[model samples]
Target: MKAWALLGAPKNQWPSNIKAKLLAAKKSKDLIIGVDRGALLLEELGLTADLAVGDFDSLQKDELERIESKVSDIRYSLPEKDLTDSELIMRCAFCDYQVSHLAILGATGGRLDHFMSNLLMVLKPEFNPFAEKIELIDQQNSIKFYNAGKHTIYQIPDYNYFGVVTLTAVQHLNIAGAKYSLADFNGDYPISFSSNEFLSEKKPLELSLKKGTVAVIQSKDIDRFQNI
Candidate 1:
């Protein structure tokens, strides 16, 4: 798969494992997009964005200049625009490069509004086509969406728990190979099955849905939450 990385500005420090993952993706020919101060953060980590984009109000003039000097391509939006810098990155990624698979970093532990916006953006009409290809990733968890279909989820060595949440009403949802197994579950609104663990460390989790879309999250232990 062609991977794309999008970085945002968050209050928490970026995790080392995720940094390594981004580097691996870069080595595999994935492109990176950095928004505002995220561009500076990428430069600090010895990485350069293929495209650096944002309103850039948060960055000082010298910082912006530094990013401009290093990034191969850059675009600026008006500070008063409707979309957040993160959304701008996603828009350009899809329109300019037809990005299909994307990994997002620095999306959590920031302003609550920004964090919630990042999570819900995938459900927007403009994002529906790429829903399954987008993921919100951090050191503690990786979140992905799926439309009605049979799917298999693998255990991430870094995470010990998983959750399945209905973004909308779902019908006939079934899950297996987890601590809690559900069969023929139906719900009228968004529902969350949280803090579940793999049945066996060696096997993958199985899930199927006859109708509706869902979000799946593989997360580290709660005690490790601080690290995120």
Candidate 2:
């Protein structure tokens, strides 16, 4: 089964159509797991989370009580635990629930450290096996992880730009069906092939890699100043 995890990033950073996205997931019977303040967001949207997981340091007594009342299954963690709330929820989704695919929302655009942590957590030995099964999504971007392999990436609508970023030293990288294709590229360190676009939305973008973990980020231009 698929699962969708809602993390506790800033509300302003949430996708404008977050409700619609969640509704679609709900329609597809995807398990919804809310992390910390993300549970509150679900409540505010008149939806109940399938499970709630977090230390909930950001919540007050009443807010925690409210979530407790709404969600049937809640997992509490110590605030001083070694794992971050994001990692906790991810582990729960993958290990406990054994979800095939986990789509994470509200993981970006708030507290650069937290965003970075979420992005890099999949690199851990424990999570690396499931890297390609996880995706981080926000208003302006959708980021998918990959291990060394030939992969086909279908375009996500409204995302005009596509990028391939190496999280580690990558070898024999090739990109096709893009505005700017790469052939037999190798890098000793993390690098980004950014600002590429799909040659045709109908055709899938092809990527091949011999070694390393990679992140495919599809994004749309947004007015940085408008929300600030």
Say which candidate scores most in lDDT: 2
> In candidate 1, what residue range of length 10 has the lowest lDDT sum?
4-13
| Alpha-carbon TM-score of each model against the true structure | 0.88, 0.94
**Residues 1-228, model 1: lDDT tens digits:** 454555554635455565677688779778887877788887777788888888778889999988888898898988788877767777888878887677788887777788778777777778766778888886577899887889988888858899999988899999998889999999999989999898767888999998878889988754555556
What are the Cα lDDT values of the candidates? 0.80, 0.89
Q: Name the 10 consecutive residues with the lowest summed lDDT in model 2.
A: 82-91
Off by over 4 Å in 2: 223-228
Error of 2 at 225 (Å): 7.7
State which candidate has the highest TM-score: 2
Q: Put down candidate 2 lDDT per residue, 52-89, tens digits, no spaces.
A: 98888898999999999879999998878888877887
